[model samples]
Target: GGSIKHDISVPVSRMADFIAQASEAVTARLPGIRPVPFGHIGDGNIHFNLSQPVGMDKSEFLALWGEMNAIVHGIVRGMGGSISAEHGVGQLKRDEIAATKSPVEMAMMRALKQALDPKGILNPGKVV
Candidate 1:
């Protein structure tokens, strides 16, 4: 239950390539590890989960989040993928998504949010 999850997506054409390249990079940097790469390939979103190398400390293993995220997401974005796929934005990726999405798209999303929640009290600052 303590595992971190990143719901990322890539273009259909680049799905296989992204998985191969990303898995290769992560393993190269962190040896003796097995990446549990599994997700929706049709939509190009792979839940690239990594378990600690045998006998490795969990805390020490998790301390590599920043570096691992940068490496994985960098490849995903380089291939035109959204680092946050089906999983709606939370505190972790709110600013990151906002910075990348276009103004028009963001405006439309906000309009929809306001329409459904006119009082701005329903889950405010959660999705929009």
Candidate 2:
């Protein structure tokens, strides 16, 4: 009934693998799940969209949003890719973005954030 959209990017070398692996992963999780991978190939950005299977209840299909995100994002991470390739990381992925970063990377990111917003006024706590 509705779709879950992923704005992800991987290295050019891994584009094909990303698509294949993600598609296979989701299909295994929910048979009949349609994996729509399309976008700027040159930039390694694939707007991975998932359409619910036919005859399924809309709410039932939508309930798998988080699980599907985990499935696809895991592949993206394994490929050394960005989960947010185009649109900024919104509420759906804000926590995930931070959780996936290494401690060192998180520390560096916090240092930079501190430098940029000493008072924590700008989009306070919106990013890692």
Candidate 3:
């Protein structure tokens, strides 16, 4: 629990500025937090994770997963970044995909899913 990982997307135009502001916000809230901010700059997708403050217990730090997600994801989403980024909508982020993806897009996706897996057995109860 001593580390956290947040994969998020930002608009290409706001990538640099968004990361800067987000990192600053994290540092301000949790001094000494090790920000391991890295990822696909071309796609404006950044994995902004943080290691525990030096010498802090990893388990205790990891307990802040939801809080860390809130902070980082909040900032990233505010800048129009996808919280799921490159990770396809497995069970973990299905609802998030639904929330972010458009209706027409979702419909098209459903059609593709049905076409590929007519039995609906593939990845059942996952994406669609």
Instruction: Give the winner by TM-score.
Output: 1
Task: Give the lDDT of residue 31 in candidate 2.
Answer: 99
lDDT of 2 by residue, 15-128 (tens): 999999999999999999999999998999999999999898889999999999999999999999989877755567778888677888767867887898899897776553
lDDT for every model? 0.78, 0.88, 0.78
Model 3 misplaced regions, further than 4 Å: 97-99, 102-112, 118-125
Q: After superposition, how far is residue 47 of candidate 3 from its true place, in Å?
A: 1.9
Candidate 2 deviant stretches above 4 angstroms: 103-125
lDDT score, candidate 1: 0.78
RMSD to the true structure for each prediction, in A, is 2.2, 2.4, 2.6
Deviation (Å) of 111 in candidate 2: 7.8
Write model 3 residue lDDT over 66-119, tens digit each, in one string.
Answer: 777778777876877777777645776667667677899788878888898899
TM-score of model 2 vs. true structure = 0.82
Query: Candidate 3: what lDDT?
Result: 0.78
Per-model TM against the reference? 0.83, 0.82, 0.77
User: Once model 3 is optimally superposed onto the true structure by TM-score, how far is the C-alpha of residue 103 displaced, in angstroms?
Assistant: 4.1
